[model samples]
Target chain A: MAESRHLGDIILKIDHISLSFGGIKALVDISFQVRRGEFLAIIGPNGAGKSSMLNVINGVYHPQTGTVTYKGETRHHMPPHRAAELGIGRTFQNIALFKGMTVLDNIKTGRSLKIKPNFLMNAIWFGPARREELEHRRKVEEIIDFLRLEDIRRTPVGMLPYGLQKRVELGRALAAEPDLLLLDEPMAGMNIEEKQAMCRFALDVNDEFGTTVVLIEHDMGVVMDISDRVVVLDYGRKIADGTPDEVRQNPEVIKAYLGVGH
Target chain B: MIYRETGQYKSNYGADEQIFPIRQDRIGVMIILALAYLVVPFIGNDYWFSAILIPFLVLSLAAIGLNLLTGYAGQLSLGSAGFMAVGAFAAYNFMLRIEGMPFLLGFILAGLSAAAVGIVFGLPSLRVKGFYLAAATLASQFFIEWVLTKFPWFTNYSASGVITAQKMVLFGYAFDTPVSRYVLTLVIVTLLALVAKNLVRTRTGRDWMAIRDMDVAAEVIGIPMLKTKLLAFAISSFYLGVAGALWAYCYLGTVEPQAFELTRSFQLLFIIIIGGMGTIVGAFFGAAFIVFFPIFLNLFTSTVFAGQLDPGMLSHLEQFVFGSLIIFFLIVEPLGLARLWQLGKQKLRLWPFPH
Candidate 1:
């Protein structure tokens, strides 16, 4: 717990990253450093490669150029599972949840790396397997309570409302206890109240769990309020990167958000 | 009224996490066990054992195997009979070649051999899925049957290509009697079904389901796609293999490669689809339905028609009725009999009040 509170070192560094799909470039020369416990927001117009950037960070997309450094280990390309193993967790822009699974089971899957898998032990439900399952069940229960998903704990995720599904996805990501949590449009399509709730959860996760956050959001007000720093992207290029106040005052950020003068 | 769980408060996680958490369910399972172990052996004649119970039990085990891959892992397989054949022939070979090899040990070895073949065939699942994967797995069915039929060595130089299974003996006690063999099958099936139940509630089961539901999210969440898929195949194949061995030694009393044809694989697929995919109990439900429905049709026709129809026409009628019923069940209740059972339990919980 103490280890999570004291945060200073750069946990994730996306240095000079350039990703392209054939003729089109999704991201060009995108460089940023995320410190531990920082709430960083990436805000941009539609088609600004916001999701593609998150995909890059979580190793879903291997950029054609530049290296990703995490916990001092640098790599040109990493698989998504490898990123997950290195304490990086992400939710999809389109809400990628296990639709068939119950809320508890979905969250329990987040604790996959915590326990060693043994076929025989699991088959008998004895010794370490049983104990570890109970132990993680307790942990997952705590997450369910934290997310206020107690009533629908046994409900299949596909049956839940979109907002609740988003919360459950957050719970699933939090269950991993990742050092870096990437949330893509967590508050998208939600009402004002649901957006407020999501914002509170995001801030609480940043403050309480000391989890470094890289959020891709379009809500300028929400992004400006909760984020410690904002990185603005336009047409796959980083326009401005600084604190909200500094970036808001910057002429280029304004032109990007508004439009270029005739 | 008796199916409720009003006062069953679980003080511990262990208690809450049981396979059958409800007291009524636990008692129901106990009763079923009692009937299967104590009552059935005495009451069931040879016809019942031969025509219904043994085949049901064996197919149920195979259904569980298919469920693990298709139901849980989202990998469509069409080679269950091939795996079963591998087990039957492998068990035969083990007992034949190794001096003084116990039949039970040979069954285990047969399962392991099938698991190995399962992994080899399962390699394509990583790159392909759904119908494509099903087509890929079909190779195992044809390849295994060909190997068994073409090679004389598998049958130990038998000209007929159908080998008589070795006698079942444990500690010099011959399981020659129908009741004894039924008991053995029941014990093995029960233990294995429980193991399957336990497995589905744990880490391995979760991983398979995760892959099934969403591979991308599963990968992002650190569930390795290759390892989980292959493990599902291996375990599922292992179960099918044992079921095959049981089919040969206990049910059929003869091993023939042709016995595990492509149609048998489809039969196993139907069992899971109609039983309820992704459930251990659904396998039993499906197997029971498959084994009993045809008999029920025949009985109904005989009683209603009263010898008016010819035997050939009656047989065709039975097939037609069976096919229609399967289609009806699929359209009416796609989740299978297990979901229907769950709905019934839900209704029972709200009974007396009409809620």
Candidate 2:
């Protein structure tokens, strides 16, 4: 697994993108390139527009300027579902699992694009629809097993602990079989043990699936430990971008973290 | 004890994903189907057929329709009766205009017509939600009623705008008697209900539910909001249309625009609320409650009072009691009757064990 973990050509290129809400700028001319099969971390203080950057990547937000090139196709604006169809899947900062549904069903929902729907076939639950449902169920069960959520397979996601819910959200994104996985503070509110488990899962996802991962985190230790590259954002602009060691040595990033007046 | 699934094991995902995955549930459903098809026809009388069963089944279908939209898809609609009226009138026109058109074919056509209207009305849901969306749908109810009443063509130039439904003829067989009508309703309702059950478990159903639970997350996750919302409206109206056709042909034998009024839409809404939103069985439970509760109240009141209370006052008393009970049930179980049923089954499965 370690030998196979090699970064290839650039998969996602964010051009000089600028985004604003009325008068408040969320992102200002922020640019970055994510190589194929690499774990990239975006770190920032509160309101640093980390989540907004993820949103832009997944097409939840359209920047006023610049294009997102994914798998060689560049687009100024893409719908969220179209982005998902193009193999970009994301989890929210807040746990966004379908609360009413069981864990199994929630994961299965990630496979929405995979299932070619036939209304009549689905209504009857026969032939191709039935077979497809079984097939997807198998895949979802595998995800459940992979995430060690077998005990809670039938449990409603709302009933789970915050850490477990975040894990399940990751499981849901993984179920989508995405080429690019975007995680927004997945370890937020988790204990040290849960954080370690989450980090392990993230590493496994990158190593085994060879999927490109973009993570937003505030934990400096976790970021320095896991990420191949780190992009530090302060006040809607990229301050530093390099390997974790190089980013740590950069005075600009230290000033952003340690504060200007202090 | 009877609901136990201790020994039953699903070897595959296919077995596990069944609508009734538990053996006991499968058996229970089979028994219910057997009773409905084999036993009910022989035992039920004309009053039972017309007054209770037929309306209950039809309304259950309509409730299921509304449940799919409001309950599953989270789109509040106030135009269910209007869609039903479309079905009733469309069926009427199909039978009248076409030479020798089959009743089943006419019903399907009526459903399609209602579906079209439902789509048009459902457009507003894309922009608004909650009370605003409900208000938007109310326009469909008033507008549909106005169109049906304003035009003499819908009523075939009838002065009162009341359209007597054409004879329900199949492939050379007429469903004339109460038992026959009841059977027809039971079959259609059961089929549609099963179809509904299947739908709610499939990907389509999950997408609707995802939208309902959280639209922003749902959209971000790639569930197309426009297509999903519109499909919910169209399918919901299709079911409502069929139910309306059944109401005209089998239950009432005649329907005017007044019959499918705003009050009727409220009744349908009440059924889903009382029965349990988002559950197919909840629709049936709600329909049964709505249909039988009043009659039960009347029976209890009349027998207990024995003409001591005036009929007019007694009816008012019944309404008071009914309203209170509805509020009580809602307060007791906001998830509705289906949840109660689920809890009961859960308790039964763990009988005599504290854990």
Candidate 3:
């Protein structure tokens, strides 16, 4: 497991990040770094602070204690919108698609960040607004094609199957064209085939765009198969962080996974 | 075959993004507009034009405004009547205070005034949501109505708390004639509806919908919730305000503070709920239901049981029918007439082919 020593190149540095809800500590002094163009999996038992870590990274929960440095900039109390504006995109553990909107429209919503046409132009239906809308639509269609959602492009996301809905969520996150993508349990409820398709899409996204991915996954097989590194958490602390092989062999991770005293 | 889009090629983005991409819809809209402008005035009598058409058009405009806020933006507001009162009172003050003020200018100023009031009232939405926010809007409704009734200055120190509108002229022609008033209202309603339709298709409209759907997710996605929600309030109030001015100046010609009351807000809310909440066309549908149904009911009651049924009985019957209809529509199709229209289209698309 010596190859575990080189866990890609570090891209996101989380330093002493801690979060608490009144008396309960969700995450306590947890720190981790994700490498550029790397797939980092965060896995833990329920209430083990895995999701809290993702929330801190995406600015959903502001960490009370340390700084999150992304691309060498120290992020302090930055809001989710600011994080999104700085090329950070994320999907929720629960599906967060605009339910009433069509797949195309939902994906198009992700491109809202890229659209800079002024209100006057949009109000008047002028040249620049029309051009920008068309351009953005073209890009969205490309995403639709990439995600193989062409048939259901005009169908409402609410009516789609859960698996396709998850894919659409991924398409939506990808629509933002973020440098760092966060997926909160992308394959939580999926069957094996759906999981495979989602993993392939994740790999393609990483390989094609060279984007950094931080995923919270419970499926160890999927995590070990795709993740360049895996960070194991237990009781609001980072119990282990290394290559999948090293984390798999770590005695503490085994005890946490098995629920037995070492 | 009647509603087909075959052979209709959109070569560019402009063509594709046109408000009505289907040529038939555009052509149908043009024909309807022409009919509204040219034909309605010629056929309608004075009572129809003055008592029915003008009021219907004005109320329809107000309903459209409320629908934009309550339906599209997902912000339930009970202050529509108050906003309308603001428009009416503001327009009155503007007209009476300023010498040689144009009739159009009074309406414009009134709309702006309503927008200001609406923004102030909408502040509570940032801290509250759903039923709580709705209850807060009720405060706007009560407060504005109280001001309109209490302040003698609003009614120009009149003891009766009523104001009569002066004769209105746009350019050279007076809107004194019923035909001219009807035509003017038709034109204004058409223009405003077009503007509203276009508004919902843009960034601001999308922002409103985003906030409506899920404010938390919208904020995370970089939509400024406060700004977007406030813009919805302002625009919606502006439309309601203008409609209010038109209601007073053109339709009533004499107005009292009691004219825009809590009952008026309920009427508008019912119109939207019965019409279809989020769809633009639902405003007109709801308005027509609220306005014409009552008239039709009265006429039918008087005609069918002339001198047989008591007046109170007839009123009771009307109320029962109205309440039942609202409940029936809500239960059967909560999406309103818009869903029915979509269903009809879908049926037509699959015509001659059985499942």
DockQ of each model against the real complex? 0.85, 0.78, 0.55
lDDT of each residue in A117-179, candidate 1, tens digit only? 587899999999999999999999999988899999999999999999999999999999999
Docking class of 1: high
Q: Which regions of candidate 1 are displaced past 4 Å? A: A1-7
Put down candidate 3 lDDT per residue, B1-355, tens digits, no spaces.
6776778987875686678888878898899888888888899899999999899999999999999899989999999999999999899899999998998889999999999999999999899888999899999999998988887889999988989987788788789988888888888899889888877776667777777876766776777778889988999999999999999988998999889998999999988988888888889988988889889988888899889989999899988988898788789889887777767777776676744
Q: What digit string (tens of lDDT, one per residue) describes model 1 on residues B47-160? A: 998778999999999999999999999999999999999999999999999999999999999999999999999999999989999999999999999999999999998989
The TM-scores, chain A only, for the candidates as listed are: 0.96, 0.97, 0.95
Which structure among the candidates has the greatest DockQ? 1
lDDT of 2 by residue, A1-262 (tens): 3235688999999999899999999999999999999999999888989999999988889899999999999999878998999999899998888999888888988888788866779999999899999988888888888899999989999999899999999998999899999999999888899999999999989888989999999899999999999999999999999989999999999898887783
Q: DockQ-based ranking, best first?
A: 1, 2, 3
Report, in order, each candidate's fnat. Answer: 0.84, 0.68, 0.37
Give iRMSD, candidate 1: 0.8
Off by over 4 Å in 3: A1-10, B9-13
lDDT of 2 by residue, B186-226 (tens): 99999999999999999889999999887877887788899
User: How high is each candidate's TM-score?
Assistant: 0.98, 0.99, 0.96
- iRMS (Å) per candidate: 0.8, 0.9, 1.6
Clashing pairs in 3: none
